[model samples]
Target: MKALVLSGGAGTRLRPITHTSAKQLVPVANKPVLFYGLESIAAAGITEVGMIVGETAEEIQEAVGDGSQFGLKVTYIPQEKPLGLAHAVLIAREYLGDDDFVMYLGDNFIVGGIADLVEEFRTNRPDAQILLTQVPDPRAFGVAELDPSGQVVGLEEKPQQPKSDLALVGVYLFTPAIHDAVRSIEPSWRGELEITHAIQHLIDASAEVRSTVIKGYWKDTGNVTDMLEVNRTVLETMERRIDGEVDEASETIGRVVIEKGVRITNSRIVGPVVIAAGSEVSDSYVGPFTSVAENCRIADSELEFSIVLRDSSIRGVGRIEASLIGRHVEVTPAPVVPSAHRFVLGDHSKVQIRS
Candidate 1:
């Protein structure tokens, strides 16, 4: 089986940061969100992979060259615009050929791997198998309505009034049968060929459309809050280590990993915190659930539950919590200002003063 990962999308929700980098490349625990999906595909023993890229194609290509580092061979498929999920599949028809492929969203993070689901799909050989999970706001996502027997009987994308609370997860498994479905459906009102519509077409045609309800942690990481949350979740499972220098004045606690070339002096770090290589923490308090990326410098500051990316500096910051500082940025305390009372006694007729 092969994998088709969608790495293209105009990440409007994650602006500012997405304005500078691809949303798929957002770091969770200092690792790109796209890498997590790629790793999961590799773990499932799927090596032949095709990546769908859009406007930020060059950036994605530079970061993920041939996919050789991840034990998979990657082929770049360019999309002029993000028409829709179904459009991605339509354009990738040549790369997918006649093989069954798993479609994954690069920016999505599913805690567990897809091995189990892949096994189920291979065993049943369903025309299409989709993962669903209960979401608080179903209207914002492509929702699925189930029948009395819990079968997916209806599908809607970003509806005003959702039919069910079960929303589609970012992972999908499909056989070559889906190729025909894509061509059969026309564009939706939004002028894009939504995958939900194509899947509905298959359902209408009596195709074997199966659904699996996932209970594990999953996130699209489309915004700052979700990015921070995913980072915290991944950090919770990290192992403890001290590979670099820690001065006698420095103190390390809990599950902390100091990568090689990291240097800590007179700082107190409480894990699960990760200090990447070439990072230096001096005279600071590095609190829990934080990741200091490579070449970053944190001096005379206090940080907790934050992610400081490569070459960034946070010195004399007083205190910072729950922030995503981008690469090569500098964060320091604002200048001090004096507060005093000035006297102005000039009114002659009816001047009133209270002290």
Candidate 2:
């Protein structure tokens, strides 16, 4: 089976950051989210793959060139626009001709991987197989309602009134028959043909559509909140190692990894943290659940539960938590000045005084 990884969507939810970078390339535990999907697919024994990319095609092309790094040969399939998941299937028809394929959304994080799912699909060979999980807000995702016989009876995308808490996870397995299903459906009210609609077409036509509800952790890292949460989750499982430099004056606590070329001096770093290459932490406190990327500088600052990208700096800042700081950025204390009283008094005796 071939793997079709979707990296095309314009991530509007992760704005400001996505404005400059692709959402799939966002780091969790110092590795890109898309890389996790590629590696997982490789481990599943799928090597012939295609990646669907959008305006940020060049960025992905550079990072995943030829896909040989992950033991896969990749073909770049460009989607002019991120119309819908159905549209992606439509465009990749030639590459996926007559073969079963697994479609993975780039920004989705699935803990415990999809190895078992692939094995099940290969054995059963269903027309379509979807991964489902019980989410608190089913209306926010593609939801599936089951029949009394445990079959998928209905599916809806971001519906206002959802029928079930079972949200469709980002991974899907489909047979060649799905090509006709995509062509048979009309665009939805959103002006694009949704994959859910296409899958519904298959179900209505009596095609076998199976679903597996997972108990493992899964997240669509489409926003800052989810991104940070995934980062923390991945960091929690990091193996304990100190592979790089640490000065005598620096105290390296449990499970800290200082990558090659990293220098730490006069700093207190508690781990389950990774400090990337060429980064220097001097006179700072680098706490747990944080990843400091390459060529960064942290001086006289304290950071915890945060992610700092390459070429960034944090100096003289008191503390930071649960932040996703971008590349080439700087965070430092504001200018110090003499104290002066400034007060505001409002109704009900509400007052804020700043000095």
Candidate 3:
């Protein structure tokens, strides 16, 4: 079986970071989100892979050139635009010819890998198989409705009123039979051929459409909040390894991995944190669930539950939390001004001021 990875999207939700970089290239735990998906695909013993790329095609190609790093041979398929999921499959028909393939969204993070899912699909040979997870907000995802017997009976993409909380996860498995389904379906009102519609077509034709409700963690890191959450989740599994230098003035506690060339002086780092190579943490409080990427500097600040990208520096900032700092960014304290309150009082107006 082959794998088709979708790495193209406007990523408007993550702007202005996405303005400068592909959303798939955003790092979680100092590693690109797309890399994780590629690694997962390789782990499933699939070596021949096709990548669907869009406007940020060059960037994606540069980062994942040849895909040999993951022990896979990658073929790049260019999409003029991110029409939809089914549209991606439509263009990739040549590369995916006559072969069952796994479609993985590059930016999505599934805690457990897709090895078991691939194995199940190979064993069952369903026409199409989708992974589903219970989500609080079903309207934001493609949702599925199962019958009393737990069979997939209906599917909708971003419905206003969902029939069920079971939303489709980013991973999908499909046989060559799906080619006809894609050709038979019409574009939705959004002018894109959604994959959910194609799956619904199969359901109407009495084809074997299967669903697996995964209880493991899954997230689409398309926005800042989700990105930070996924980062924290991945960091939670990190083992403590301090290969860097920590001065006597610093205190490191809990499960923190300090990569080589790191220097910590007069700073305190809490558990489940990862400081990448060549970073310097001095006179700061690095709290839990934070990842400081390579060559970064943190001084005279307090940061927690945030991701600081490579070459970024945070100095003299009092406190920061739940933030996604991009690469080569500098954060510093705002200049102080004299305290004053100036106001023009209107007639019969009462005001109270704190001195």
Candidate 2 off by > 4 Å: 337-355
- Candidate 3's clash total is 0
lDDT of 3 by residue, 134-154 (tens): 999999999999999999999
Q: After best superposition, candidate 3 residue 33: deviation in angstroms?
A: 0.9
Clashes of each: 0, 0, 0
- Write out the backbone clash pairs for model 1: none
User: Which residue ranges in model 1 land beyond 4 Å of their true spot?
Assistant: 340-355
For model 2, the run of ten residues with the poorest summed lDDT? 346-355
Q: Comparing 2 and 3 by lDDT, which wins? A: 3
Candidate 1 C-alpha lDDT tens digits along 1-355: 9999999998998887788889999788889999999999999989999999999999999999999999999999999999999999999999999999999999999998899999999999999999999999988899999999988898999999998899999999999999999999999999999999999999999998999999999998998788888989999999998999999999999999999999999999999999999999999999998988999999999999988888999989789998888888998888988865566666675555565
- TM-score for candidate 2, residues paired by index: 0.95
Give model 1's TM-score versus the native structure.
0.95
lDDT of each: 0.93, 0.92, 0.96
lDDT of 2 at 162: 97
lDDT string for model 2 (62-81, tens) is 98999999999999999999
Q: Which pairs, if any, clash in model 2?
A: none
Locate the minimum summed-lDDT window of 10 residues in model 3. Answer: 346-355
Alpha-carbon RMSD of each model: 2.6, 2.7, 1.1
